[model samples]
Target: MLLSGHCLIVLERTVLAASPAEGCALLIGRRHAEALWVQRIWPCCNRWEPASERQRHFQLDPREQLLAQRWVRERGLQVLGAAHSHPSSPAVPSLSDRERSLGPTLLLIRSGLTDDPHPLRAWWLPEPAALPGPAPEALPLPLEAPLTGDLGE
Candidate 1:
């Protein structure tokens, strides 16, 4: 499905903010372009290095996960996708990343430092059930700064 205009804007901003050390979230809706509606979810990250892995990986901190759960409940929205920055590499997901993904989720990879030339890339990790169904679709979209102010306002 195509991203709504507003959602596109938010996704861009999230990509811009990613660093190798942290990750971000985006709440999405299945809707048409003109009537775009989306929310940006900035969840907390718990960083850890896997025994067999060299790159740092992160999971949602409890509080952040709670917040995400609540936000989804209150808004009746889906977790459309998530994003993270790779301090040293591109925002692409590693093998571990693929194993941890939950659904037809969006993965945004950012390269370099958080404040430096943060190029955003997008990928979709389909549910295991979807494997052998079709090839994953990767779309390259421009990352734009997010609109400011509370979502409720």
Candidate 2:
């Protein structure tokens, strides 16, 4: 149900390992009138690797891509969108990010130290068309630990 303003959507181990330090994006699909929801999370690729001193780019490996596609197809879920993280930069897509975007996909960018022992700032990528039409608005998804403290660890 569009879990807005929340980081790390509490996924299974399979999904988490696929996207550890980089970042992950998923397209969630649900029936129009049902509570059941399914997601296909994929790792965002860092095309600008090397050029950014190994700090500016993050790209999905081939294996992750294959798994993402398979997850969507097997689950019969329509890829609603994609997501990723900034690691050090803000949780917003850079110019290169826009250039590499696919369609009207939902992109999630996480920012902060992954091992800092604290939550990080997470934002949703606004629809490309929404950029020029009006002030870009991003959905803030803060990461909070569940009460159970079971972050799939």
Candidate 3:
């Protein structure tokens, strides 16, 4: 989940905008020798979780996931990871989050959005065992320069 500071800021804004509910998106980027470069943020609607359950859970619509996968491929990139808001909870994954974990892909959670630190955390579910060695985890993934200027995208 190596991304520019610009992407981080964007994620923060998105989560805050959707406060009280879970905001979800796809982190698409290319793989580099030193890191997974996040080149784009694909915001997707949380489709499966009913409106009432959104405060605590998120379900990336299968349709959106397919579309995002296609879009990432079109850009010559891959699904580097996923991002979602945790509402008022801490940035730690809940038991349900772990139970539903697919393992391997970088999963980012933004929690405490209504307070200081507004933590945006990352984790490596089970490590991509197919890789030659232990692939680097999402955290400690270097933050690159801002992807844009204040002027706008």
> Could you list the CA RMSD of all candidates, in the order they appear?
5.8, 5.8, 4.4
Q: Regarding lDDT, does 1 or 3 come out ahead? A: 3
Candidate 2 local Cα displacement, residue 9, angstroms? 6.1
Q: What lDDT does model 2 reach?
A: 0.48
User: How would you order the candidates by TM-score, starting with the best?
Assistant: 3, 1, 2
| Tens-digit lDDT track of model 1 for 1-153 | 344346655555564454434555554543344332334545445444562232466665567666776777687775666666565665566666677778667666655545545366667787856554444555655434445665541
Q: Tens digit of lDDT per residue, candidate 3, span 1-153?
A: 477877887777766577678888888888876467887788888774468888888888789889998887787888877788888787766666665657666778888545736377777666434434443343754677645557364
Q: Write the per-residue lDDT of candidate 2 for residues 1-153, one digit (tens) a residue.
A: 243222245332223343334545554555445232333344344443553443555555556566767777787776555555555666556776665566455555555545544233323345565554432456544323334544354
Candidate order (lDDT) = 3, 1, 2
CA displacement after TM-score superposition, residue 13 of candidate 1 (Å)? 7.3
Estimate the TM-score for candidate 1: 0.61
Point out the worst 10-residue segment of candidate 3 by lDDT: 129-138
In terms of TM-score, which candidate is stronger, 1 or 3? 3
| TM-score of each candidate structure, all chains considered together | 0.61, 0.56, 0.80
For model 1, name the residue pairs that clash: 12-143, 12-144, 20-87, 91-109, 91-110
Task: Tell me the whole-model lDDT of each prediction, alpha carbons only.
Answer: 0.56, 0.48, 0.73
Report the C-alpha displacement of residue 37, candidate 3, in angstroms.
1.4
